[model samples]
Target: MSLRGPGGERSRWRWLRGLRARLALAISVILVAALGTAFVATYRGTGTQVRNQIDEDLRTDAQLVDSRLPLLRAKPGEIAEAAEEYLDERALFPLSARLFMVRIRGAGNISNLPDLSTAEGDPRLDRDVAGPRRESDESRALRTADLGFSTVRVNDEPLRLYFVQVTRGGRAVAEIGVGESAASVARAQSGVARTFLVAGTVTLLAAIALGFAFATRLSRPLRRMAGTAARVSAGDLSQRIGSTGPQDEVRVLADAFDRMLDRLENAFARQRGFVADASHELRTPLTVIRGQLEVLARQTDVTPDDVRHVDEVVRTEVVRMERLVEDLLLLARADEGELVRPAPLDLAPFVTELFDALTLTADRTFELSDVPPGRLLADEDRIAQVVRNLARNAVEHTGPGGLVRLTVRSLGQGRLEFALEDDGPGIPEEQRDRVFDRFHRTDTARARRTGGAGLGLAIARAIVEAHGGRIYADSSPEGGARVAFALPGFRAAGKRAAKEQAAKS
Candidate 1:
C-alpha cells in the first residue's frame, strides 16, 4: 500500500511485474542475444578463414621449396641467393614481405637465409627457424611441418607466420618458414569487438527506457480505475472512470462500472424521494384519525367496560399512528437535510434533562455519569431526541429491575461522545449493522407486545448524521447493548467581568 520511489530496491525489479515491460524486455533480450551470437560466429569464422589462407600459402611454399631442393643441393652456396630472388619476384605484394628460414638435419644446423638478415622483418619466421626442430618422422607427406598460421612479434611489430618443411625421398631434408606482418588483422579484430560492445550497450539502454515509458502508459488507465473503485466503495456513487481510446476490454470494463454507479446513485436518490413523499402523504390521514379518536374519547353516557374498551383501542391506534408518523417524519427530514442545525450549546444539561424525563416514564432505574458540560455545534433538540429514543428503547428491552446508564464525555479536539447502556440482551453481531436500517426489528413478538415500532434506532442514526455526527451499536461492558454517538464540539463564549464591563460602559 505504501508508495515506492525510483532507484529504491523494489524499483529495479518493478519492470518485471508489468506486462508491457516484460514484453519489451523479452524482445530486447532475444535481439541482443541473437545479434551477439551471430557477431561472434562471423568474427571467429572470418579469423579462421584468414588463418586457413595463411596455411595454404605455407603449404604452397613448402612444395615450391621441395621442387627447388635438388637444385639447391647441387649448389649448396647458391640456396639463399635463389630464395631471395624467388621472394622478390613472386611474394613481394604491396605491404607484404616474405622471409625464409632454412635448417638442415645436423645437430646444429639452424640457419637464416643469407639474404634475409634484416631486423625490419617478420619475427614469426625467426621463431620457427630458431626453435628446436620437430621430429623428422612427424613431418607431413610434402615434407612440411604444417605449422598453422599464427600472430607473433617481428622487430616490435605484430606479424603472421606460416611454416613448411622439406624432405627428400622419405628422409627429412630441411625446414622452410615464411611470415608476413599482421597489424591490419589485429586492428580489424579490435574494431569489430569495439563496434559490437558500443552497439549492444546503446541498444540495451534504449530498450530499458522504452520499456519504462510503455509500462507507464499501460498503468495509467488502471490507476484511474482503482481510484474510481475506491470512491465508489466509500459511498461516492457519483464518481466513475472515463473511457479512453477505442472500445477495448479496458474501456468496456470502465463503461460497465460507470453504468453500475449510475444505477446505484439513481436508486438511492429515488428511494430517498419516495420515503419523503410517503411520509408526507401518511401524515394528513393520521392527523384526522387522531382528531376523531380524541372526539370519541370525550363521548358521554358510555358504560365503564365499553368506555375502557373504546379507550384502549383509541390509545393503541394513537400510539401506532404516532410511531408511524414520527418514523416517516425522521426519514423525510433526513432526505431534506433539515434535522440538525449547528450551534454551540452545552450537552450535559440537555442529557440530564432527558434522563430525568425518561426516568419518570420507565420503571427501570436510570444512572447518569461523567456528563461533562461540553459545548457542541449541533442541533440541541435533535440530539436530545436521539437520547430520548435510545433511552426508551433500552428501557423497553431491559428486564424488570435492570439498570440503564447514560454517559457523556469530551473526546478532545472538536468532538463529544455519548453512550447509553442497558442491562439487556445485546444485539447479535450479525444484526448490529442492520439494526440501524429502516424497518429492521430483532424481536417482532416483543415489538408487538410493547406496541413498539422498529424505526427508533434508524431515525436516531439519521438525526445524528444530519448533525454531522456518527452513531454505532455495540456490546456493552455491562453484558448488554450500548448505543453511542459522537458530534463536533464548540466552545461557549466566556462571560465578561462586571467591574471591567462597568468601566467600559
Candidate 2:
C-alpha cells in the first residue's frame, strides 16, 4: 500500500514510471503478443499439414492395389492370396514412409502385417492379433461406403488407414486397406515448435533492446530541459537547456522553455535595480530633512525666522519624498494590472482643460492642436495623470517662453493618438527609449533636487500600457523632445456631430 522506501524516499525503481520506460514496455508487450500468436498458428498448421500428407499416401496405396486386382481376374476365394503375392513381387509398400499395414478382405481375410510387424508393445505394432478388434469396428462403421479413411490406435499411437472396395463385372470381389503410422507427423510438428521457440525468443529480446534505445533517444532533450528547470527553481537563473537538437516538437518546447527563463531573469534584474533606486531616492530627502533638524537642534539661541526656515526646508523635502513614494506605489500596482478602472471619457474637453491647467502652471508658449471629437475607453483620472506627466517633463526641459505644443487626433478603426512637443534640448537617440526606464535620466548631469526623481516618464509609460496603449519618445518638429502615445478602443462621433462639436469649440 505504501510505496515509499526507507526514510520516506521514493523507491529506486521509480525511473520505470518515466516516459522512456513506459514507451519501451509498451513496444515490447505488443511485439511479444504478435510473436506468440504467430507461434500458435504455425505450430498447429505444421501438424495438420504432416497428417494430411500421410492420409494422401495411404489413399494412393489403396488405389494402386485396386487397379491391379482386376487384371488378375481371380475368384473371390483366391483374391486375398493373389493380392499378397502381387504386393510381395513388386515391393509396392514403402517402409520408410511408415506405410506399415495392408489388409485385403475376400472369402478369407489376408494381411501383410506379418512382414511389417514390430516387437510386442511397440507403438507401431502391425500384427493381426494386436489390431483385429479395433480394425473390425472401423470396418463396420464404414460398411455402407465404397471408399473411406479412418484413424485407429496401435499401442496408444495413432494410425491413419484408407480402405477401398475392388469390383469386377459389376460384382464386389474384395476390399483393400492401407494404413500409415502418425509418428512422423508428431516428429515434424515438434521440430517446428522447437525452431520457433528459439527464433521468437531471440526476436523478442532484440525488439526490447531496440525499443529502449529509441525511447531514450526521444526523451533525452526533455530530460535535459527538466534538469535546467530544476536548477532554475533552486535560484540559478543562469541555467539554460541551450538545445541544439533536431527541429521537432520537443526542440520547440525546449526553445520556449529557455525563452521563459530569459524573461524571468530580466524581470528579477529589473526588480533588484528598482529597489536600489527607490532606496537611494528616499535617502536623499531624508538626509536633507535630518540635516536641517540637526542644525536647528545645535543652536542654543534660535530666532522665529530661523525656525521658520528649517520648517520650510523640512516641509519641501517631505513633499518630495511623498511624491516619490506615491509614484513607486503606482508603478507597483501597474505591474499587477490593478492600477486603473476605465470608463468612457470625452477627449476634446479633457485636452482643453489640461491646456488651460498647464498654461496656469508655468510661463511657456503653450500651443494646442485641433482636438479630435471622440470618446476614449479609459480611466479619466489615469489618462489625466499621463498627460500631466508628459506636460511636466516638457515644461521642465524648456525655458520660459519656449514653445510647447499638444496634439490629439483620431486614427480610424477605433483608435486615438496624442503627441506633445517642446522646444528644448532634445533627448539623444541612444537614450530615447531608455528615458522611460525607472530612475533613468536623459539629463544625467541635472541634480536630483532639480531634475526630480526620474520616474515621471516611467510612471506615464506604465499607466499608458496598463490601458492597453503604448508610449514612446522621439525628436519634435520644433527641434526638441517629442513624446507620443496611442490608445485603442476609441469611438468617434458622426460627421454631423463632429461638425457641430467643432463649431462650438
Candidate 3:
C-alpha cells in the first residue's frame, strides 16, 4: 500500500532498483573468480618450475665434485696438495668441502692419516683431514662408496654428498668424501614464491577496479532512463532521457518510452480541447431556450382553469435542461482553452448588478457585504453568468427566512475574490472538491424534487477558470456552505480587449 510520486497515491513499482550496484557486484565477482583461478594456476606452475631448476643445480654441483676426486686420491700421501690444485683449476664449480679420507692395505689393514701439517695450502683443511674418524670403517666405506651425487639429511641438516674411490697399483689405497649445505637451493625457491605472490595480488586488484569501472559505464544509461520514466509517471510528460547509441538496448528503450509519452500528452491535450469546445458550443442554445421559456412562462394568455398543468412542468424541465446544457458547454470551452476574456472591469459594480438582477425568492433574504473596487480582466458576459449562477445556487440551498450573502473584496496584489454564502446544510468536507463536477448534487432527493439538473456549480467553475481564476467550496461562518472564486487583477487592457474583439469579429 505504499504511495508514490508527488501526489502520494499508490502506483506501480519501477524496475531499476540498484541496477548499478548489482551490475558492479556481478562483474566484480566474475573478474575476481577468473583472476583467482589464474593466479593459483600460475603460482603453482612457477613454483614447480623454480623447484626443478634448483634441483638440477644441486645435482650438477654434486656431479662436479664427484669428477674431481680421482686425481686427488692418486697421491695418497699428498692428497691435500692434489685437492687444492684441482679446486683452483676447475671452472664454474659450486662445491664446498668438509672432507674425511681413509687408507686401507691389501690385508684389510687400515691406517689413519697423520696430521700432515706440512702437506696443505690451507691449515684448516689439513687439520680437518687429520681428524681421528678418518680411520673408522664407516668413514672408509663412505669414501669408496660409488654414490655419484645425492641429497641426504646429515646431522639434521640437508646436504649434498659425493664420494669417489681411489686405488694404487691395482689395490685400494684411500677414498675421498665431500659434502655441501643445501641452503642456496631453499633460498632460490623462496624467491620464486615471493615473486608469484606479488604478481597475483596485483592482478586481483586490477581486475576488481576494471570490473567496477565497466559496470558503472554500462548502467549509467539505464539510470537516466529510469529517472525519465519516474518523471512521466508523476504526470510530467515533458521529460526525456538522453539516448546513448542505437546499438544499445537502453537507448532503444528510451526512444520507445519518449514516443509513448508523446502520444499520451497529445491524447490528454485533445481531450481537454474537446471538452471545452463542446461546452462553448452548447451555451448559446441553452441561453436561447432559457430566454424563450421565461418569456412563455410569463405570458398572461388564458384563465387558470383553462391552463394545462403540463405547461408548468414543461417550463420547469426546460429550465433544468438549459442549466445542464450551459454547464456542459462551459466545461467544454474551458477544456478546449477557447473561453473569451474582455477588457478590465470593476468588481464592485459587477457584484452589485449581479445581485440586483438575480431576484432571490421571497422566503430568503439576499445580502451584500465587503464589496471592493477590484478591477479584473475578463469576459463581462461570462463573469456575469458565473455570478448569476452562484447567486441562484445560493437561493436554492437557503432555508426559509435564511440569509444568502454575496461578498467581493480585494485579496491584494492584483487579485479579486468573490464568495457566495448561504445558511443551508454545509457540504461534507470529502465532497467539496467534487461538487464542481457536472451532474453532481449534494442533495440528490431535493435536486430531483426541484427539477435541478445539477450543473450550476460546474458551469460557474468553468467560467471562473477560463478567465485565469480558481474556485472552491468551503465552510461558511453562518454554519452553511460558502462557494468562493478568485481572479487575477487587471493588466494593460490591450490583450483582453483584442481577444474580445477577435471573438466578436
* Top of the candidates by TM-score: 2
lDDT of each: 0.66, 0.77, 0.62
Per-residue lDDT of candidate 1, residues 346-395 (tens digit): 66577777778888877897888755544677887878888888888788
Q: What is the C-alpha RMSD of each candidate to the true structure, in Å?
A: 17.2, 5.3, 17.1
For model 2 the local lDDT of residue 54 reads 82
Question: Given candidate 1, what's the lDDT at residue 394?
Answer: 86
Model 3, TM vs. native? 0.40
lDDT, candidate 2, 1-505, per-residue tens: 3554452454566678888789878987897788788878888898889888887777777776666664545675456556656557546544333342333332434444443323323434332334433554333322322357777666666767777767767666666766667878778878988888888778877877888888889889999989998999999999999888899999999999999999999999999999999999999999999999999999999999999999999999999999999999999998988999989988789889988998888999999988777788998889889988988888888899998899887766777888889999888899989988999985542552475689998999998998899999999988899999998878877787666645665
The number of the candidate with the highest lDDT is 2
lDDT of 2 at 354: 80
Model 2 stretches astray by more than 4 angstroms = 1-9, 71-74, 90-106, 115-147, 168-173, 293-307, 411-414, 445-448, 489-505
- Candidate order, TM-score descending: 2, 1, 3
TM-score of each: 0.44, 0.84, 0.40
Residue 130's lDDT in candidate 2:
45
Regions of model 1 farther than 4 Å from truth? 1-32, 53-81, 84-98, 106-159, 181-185, 263-505
